[model samples]
Target: MSEANTALSDERIKNTSRLRTALIRPELGGICGTIIVFALFLIFAGDSGMFNSQGVMNWSIVSAQFMIIAVGACMLMIAGEFDLSVGSMIGFAGMMIAIFTVTLEWPVWQAILVTFALCIAIGALSGYIVVRTGLPSFIVTLAFLFILRGFTIYLPQLIERRTIIGGIDDAAEGDWLAGLFGGKIFGGLFQWLGDNGIIATFERGTRAGDPVVDGIPMLIVWAIGLVIVGHFILVRTRFGNWIFAAGGDAQAARYTGVPVNRVKILMFMFTAFCATVFATCQVMEFGSAGADRGLLKEFEAIIAVVIGGALLTGGYGSVIGAALGALIFGVVQQGLFFAGVESSLFRVFLGLILLFAVILNTYIRRLITGER
Candidate 1:
């Protein structure tokens, strides 16, 4: 072939290969699933106010909750570890905040700070044990799951004679740090929209001409912020490469000068930090902390990470993919309620989707490894 023709042919071949690779990407499933879920919800729940501003906020908040925990779980999984203690950490952290602020009458900001420090320390301890003993992270964190849950229940009962702590709202009144987790943003913009008839407002009450959604909740903001930061750390920096290397092959990574132990331990601490963030938000929103709060949330976060296309083996994933998976969860959960379907079926959906995701991941892993 002539030089010009050969060059053109090569370009065409490259474009074709690129398309094929994109089609098989780990995020492909999450992207497709998100589209289908949204389409389905729009069709079935379109007229039910589920697409309205208020409805959008509902699902968005739920999705953000999932996104927050999933970010931490995603990074940890990418580093080849699991932290089953995440749910317990949430309850424990919230309880600690409540105990410090309410029972002990500490300032809300001080309580929040102390709770975060303690939770992160516990997470570091969990990581240290796993690294020193060479035990599976699953087992170590599972033990912590029970240990922390026990403390969550026992401490509240011992201190307040109950497993539920309240009065947080009163204590947090005018508290600056509490506002960061509990406050809303963009109030003026939402107010403008409401005045312009762009969004629904309270017709007649003590509060009239006010938007149903005053502003975006801080929970969603935290979720977006975490995703952005996590994505940057995972893809744009040297540490990001180290995470993949450590997960992909710890011994090889160590020989190559990757700080595998430190990376894994930091990931564990990060997971705990995320859990505390969730707990703080929840406590501020609800004005209470219960021992049973965050039950099974660890599994939900794992499912979100898995559905986002992170392999069970580790070293391959996308933060954006995980966020999409969380969005899918948030939509389907509220969509079912809006469509008037039984809410219990959400668990069934979780089971099915998890199975499908695992099968799909296995196929993708085999494809990458050329395994039979």
Candidate 2:
């Protein structure tokens, strides 16, 4: 009888272990949502060009850009903060870079360095204000959002006498720094494939008759690399534990010597840095800057992080989930176009998805905590 009881106990333990493993994965919600969304889109738009190489490239590029910002936003949310100024920061950074290079006639590399330094300073200031004043980050960053946006518009008009800042292409022409940030890689593989007739050539192929692979865009590379690094930092480091503790309970974490204030402030800085990276990539790709760039991107980043299963109250989230959420956004945005849906209706879709994700995340949390 004792031997039989032991065997039953072992079986129950094994089952519980599997259940706990499944429950602990914060990205599970994102993975499931991604699969469902992808399947739905595939079903409705399979006959269209949605699955084609060019179509995939289009959506993936947008998704990569969203993920670039969303990753940092997720980290900040996990640290119990928000940055409404991220979108404005993108515009501000791009404008700064363009003004530095084109108006001031500075080298591209020098302009880049100066722009990055200013971005860090702005981030530190924002963080410092929040930490020192004990004000909510939401309030502090909201103020910055307006300040940066106004400056982004007013600065160019003040100096260049116009809202649009152009001439970046001319300034960056033949510059190696521009090439490093804007150029593509893997041209040889695609060229070889095109030559070998392994891939279909466009009706109007290049003079070299190569396929239009266009290689891999630099933005996509940055998104993937940043996501990997962010994931590692969140899951494999002691600082990650501090972040969770800080967000979970600031008082308790501080009592335990977690340096909660420092962690939160650093998170704010990281958020700004990510915004700057996004701005840099866009400026390099378009070779221009304007005050209107990156509008409403802050909401989009927050939505992605929320859909990735991060709690609004803080402390539970996954970087991988945020990346998948970005992927979902990209798919839906591109799929709507392929399906002949009106682009203006995209906001409605986002609202619905955000609502559903919040509800789903809450339910998952209850299950994990065994809450009634």
Candidate 3:
């Protein structure tokens, strides 16, 4: 073959191989387990309305939100680092927005802007401490978590000016924000779901074309937008190449001119910003915020990331896949309610998923490294 033809053939081969990796089913264990989840929910719980179109509609966006955070966590994990304080940070962000608005009587716009700044700063600060001190991110974030948790406890008393901040006099003010984040999609037939739709939405009670939604949950949109950005960064940009290189082999990447430290710091900061985005959504939706808002969400994000197939040691996984992992988690949680199983059983299932995902991640890492 001529030179051009040979080059074209080589490119085709590489594209085909990568596509196979991206599109193939995950390990037999995970694919089978996921299949079982779908089957069991369908078989045993179908009668309970979980199988209906409206029920499935109810779960999709929330699942998408979880997937978003899982994408960020997956990025961090791929870079061979971790942070455990995101949950508390979300609570902090929610409380911060509420305190600025409900307590200080700040305008909604001002409060939102300030809260956004705080979250980004906090995330960067955490990243800085982790990098500068050489302490493990796990330990550092744990310390941060405790500190933030304590602050959340104090927030209500301060905001309420009496050990509680309630009687907001309006959830409407924040509705715009909520709808932007956690709004509903089609309820019944239009959605290609199982049945007709009717839900006495907690927010509007009854409204045609409204989806009768609640909350200014911009977090959901924020998460999706971030995922798109992340996808671009991961797959379509030079930064993505460095990310893979840094995570896959930091020392080598550095020797080859990657700015290793800067990328790590950026990753850490980005994760923190995600926590903030979620927190903002919660405050808009709940119309109230407390220090306890994000008590365990960070841990859940980590679990979602791992389950999505990101390797703990770095240099493996996809943003979309990790997001899917989060969906799996949210589905199971919602599924439990439909199944009427105890809440504790859901946690048990989460643990099992984590265990299996970790084992598989390790195996995938082995496969990739052997080739390297």
Candidates' lDDT values, in order?
0.93, 0.89, 0.70
Compute the lDDT for candidate 1: 0.93
Once fitted onto the true fold, the runs of candidate 1 whose alpha carbons sit more than 4 angstroms away are: 1-19
Error of 2 at 350 (Å): 0.6
Model 2: number of backbone collisions: 0
Better of 1 and 2 by TM-score: 1
Residue 349 error for model 2, in Å?
1.0
Candidate 2 per-residue lDDT, tens place, 178-245, comes to: 77667788878877877787654566735557675757888898899889999999999999998888
Residue 291 miss distance in model 3 (angstroms):
1.9
Best by lDDT: 1
Better-scoring candidate (lDDT), 1 or 3: 1
How should the candidates be ordered by TM-score, best one leading? Answer: 1, 2, 3
- Candidate 3 per-residue lDDT, tens place, 245-353, comes to 8788889998999987788888877887777777666665566776567777877888877776777778776776677677678778888989899988988999988
Which pairs of residues clash in candidate 1, taking residues 3 or more apart in a chain or in different chains?
none
Please write out the lDDT profile of model 1 over residues 43-91, one tens digit for every residue: 9899999999999999999999999999999999999989999999999
Candidate with better TM-score, 1 vs 3: 1
Model 1: how far is 352 from its true place, Å? 0.7
